[model samples]
Target chain A: MGESILQLQQIRKSFDNTEVLKGIDLEAAQGEFITLLGASGCGKTTTLRIIAGLELPDSGQVILEGRDITDWEPNRRDVNTVFQNYALFPHMNVADNVGYGLKIRKVPKAEIERKVEQALRLVQLEEYGKRMPDQLSGGQKQRIAIARAVINEPKVLLLDEPLGALDLKLRRQMQLELKRLQKQLGITFIYITHDQEEAINMSDRIGVMHEGVLEQLGTPNEVYYQPRTSYVADFVGNANILHKNGETLAIRSENIRMDGESVCTLDAVVVEKSFAGGQLRILFRLADGQLLTASRYGIDNDIQPGETVKIGWDAKDAVKVIDNDKDENQR
Target chain B: MTKTKTKGNSRRRSGNIGLLIPMYVFTILFVALPILYLFLLSFLQRAQVWGVDFTFTLDNYKRILEPLYLDTFWQSLKLAFTATFFVALIGYPYGYFMARMSAVWKRRMLLLIMIPFWTSALIRLYGWIIVFRSNGVLDKILMGLHLTDQPLKLLYTYPAVVVGMVYSLLPFMILAVYSSAEKLDMSLVEASRDLGASSWTAFWTVSFRLTLPGLLSGVVLSFIPSMGLFFIADILGGNKIVLVGSVIQEQITKGRNQPFAAALSAVLMVLTSVMIRLYRKITGTSQLEGML
Candidate 1:
């Protein structure tokens, strides 16, 4: 990551007297892929919209490239958004849609045509320029939307769950393409999604949001391994929260071993066993009825549902986390 | 089991066909039969006394080409065009803005637009007479405001007829535009703005283009009816202006020339069909803008 390109300070927003974003402060390094990950209505999209100038923050400053653009109109801002529904102009064909921003700027028609062709080539849809938006499939439309936004090459690109509507396979494919495109363009990308796997796969850093608060912001490995709060731990991945001596600790399910050597060990009965892809997931019930999930690679047919198993993990691997307001995080 | 399923499917298909019987019967009797009778009557001759001669002649069609009747058609076209232009100018923004209003405000506005319809249109036109008549409510208001020196002869004129036409047909224009504008995806505008298009540009390039189908349909609804709403011309114009419908009515009742009336009606029908065909060609869609 290079020097910071965008800064959001003490941002707040409300709708109908309900405060959606409490006070969000974030900084995005130049050319960095940052994602705001949260469940629905967690204000991730609201924050993204604020950054895009689609919504005004009730109180705060949005500084872009050393300029305060808090109250600027969306058209005046040097930022673009890729909406979840891929809001393409149905009246325009793919080429015109891609060239819309340039046309608005009154760029020469020949240059616009060349840039449109280049942008189409960037999205690998060179043959779709003459096709209407309705003629393309969902994936194709999404590519056209991306092409349209990127044709202007704004300083920052904001994506609000752009892949949310696609099938799983197409979504994964888009995630890779988006990451690659962001890297190639070297534009600061502020992405939003409720999908943790997507965030982990694409983002250089992930900001985990909960209940209008950004719980944690870190790299995917740091977030998965060293979550600051129990909420982040539970939301980002499957984790077992164990309270000992008034300190909260989060251990990743994959870190828990079956009859392996470690500093800490616990004996629990196998409550259920299921196969998940290449891994075997076992749900174990502790003596006090606390359920802990453990994932291991390959087959372990010997351990039946009724059998008792020994689970252990190193103390260093169990990162200390803050006990959150919600007690339901322990499960 | 498959045999029973196929049998059930066939039964359902036959039931569906049975349900269409009344629709077919009504279309033939009310729609097709009248057009056929009008076409046949247009080719017949008018007798010296009452009704038609029953003898075939091209005289009625030829009579429509006469300068006196041609001028009536031209005046009707001009009046309808003027009324339609005013209707579109007032209605497009009215309906478009109404669609963007908060739900409560939208419902209230829609109710305000619809409340006039509960009363008869003829009654509404009569109400307009009270406002447009010389030395009446409009004159009193203008005098009270000291905008004019004396009462103006505002009633029973061409402008009064045009106003009545607009007042009566404005709702259809509003409703037509509203139905289509309501379905406009607002995010497309936002997306345009995000892509550096100003608000005006976004509206012109995105919102206006997308809602054009509805505006065109509104024009159709207002224009076609304005030409035929001769009662408005009669009550408001005081028979000073004669439209195609007024001529057709005069031929049928006062002149007792039913075949000539049929010929005039047939010509109006052809004009309406041509307009509809032009509309379909321009819009490239068969569906009219539905009511809200």
Candidate 2:
């Protein structure tokens, strides 16, 4: 296990009678890419802001590199944030904007320019130093933001959905670029995003947040295959839960095979069938009115709507969860 | 076919011209003609009786180069510049604070700023007279408090004129800076702090520069009007002071020296945009140093 670079302990924040964050405890190890994954308004961004010292939590402790930095102002923290909107200075040119932090620290003119050029080059934007932020495209702006944060060489770089505004293809490309940057720099990156794919692909481990609480924390495979709570299973992937005798059963859409290839098989009537690019989504109803969704590719099955079929899954693939006990306090 | 194509092009061109006709007519009627007339009047001789003598002469312009008149021009520039500086100094912070305020407070502050604007400006100036003149409200309050034995001469000073100008032109400066400050992305400030810039440094690098456009517009709005608002000097300074606006007013109504007055008006008009450009340059240089 890596040494913990940052630890957030029992962070609780509320705004105008609405508790945005309920007791979030998160940890990011050195050089680890940890993501706070949640939908919008779930306090993921707020948690990131708390770590960056942009927003003070109502009650919490932020320990960075074994030091309690909770009361420190944002500039005193050893962390930088790549804002969701990039927030690049529109008036200043790229070089000025990138070198602003160095200039503020009273670094020499030549040194500031050198570090700025180096950072820009790292983002593959050596020639864009003279361009204003508005002159650059979305992807270019995102890279500039990354370069801006990366140049500081902070202990942890917080990014709040840096690619949310970009198109799908550009976002995917930047995702890989971000991952490469994280590995190349070897600095801890605490990324916050609502997109499950982005969080799963870029982060070494993801912390799933729901209504301000840290629901679960694990690697993508662990969270996806063995979700400790129903929220994690539903949020991370397509999950169909079957409630039986107070013990909830969670089966991943892909895990529940259409044909009788597993030990547990149940006869079901196909209620709905929808084609989704590469896979076919089939909704089935059991004899007891339990709805289950099974995802199969074209070559895997030929299930159609209104067709009666048998859905089966091995016992190992089915994970049981207690929905009521997990969310009683949160609600 | 070629004739029809040419006709089509001409039709489009004519349609565009037709759409612009109202603007051109309004400009010609209200703006261009007055400027041309003013320019023509500046080059002519003042009549002994009334109006202007229709003769080409540099005498009117040459009269403005006199030492006494030149002093007035210098005084006008100084006063206008001072009032503008003060307006900007006070307005930027007020505007910045207002922009950062909550919605309810923002509306309340905006209303408070506009309250004096709703009443007639002439009326407002008169109200200032009631406060500043000897044995007036200010003197009465001071005397009541026993701060002074007599009326402390609050009325007829350079500071009085400046206060009046700032009072009148403050809304323009505040609103202009507010317009820019409100549109600013606050996250940039946070980003600056995250990048290791202190709160003060972030303000200079992010908030100040981002709001420069608004501040400059405020300067233009306040400075240009202050240069021309001679009534402030006349009323507040007890008619002891004379800026370019009063000089122009005196020339037209009392002195019957319209040509020289026209020349001064032309000078002030040209100076307006020039001052804006020069102020922008000065601020620009200051910002460049700050950036370094």
DockQ class, candidate 1: high
Per-residue alpha-carbon lDDT of candidate 2 for residues A48-152, written as tens digits (9 for 90 to 100): 988988889999899998999998999988898999999998888999888877887789999999999999989999999999999999999999998988887
TM-scores, all models, native as reference: 0.95, 0.93
Candidate 1, residues B262-287, lDDT tens digits: the string is: 99888888998898899899988787
- Best TM-score among the predictions, by candidate number: 1
DockQ for all candidate structures vs. native: 0.91, 0.77
Residue A228 of model 1, lDDT score: 90
TM-score of chain B of each: 0.94, 0.87
Candidate 2 has an lDDT of: 0.87
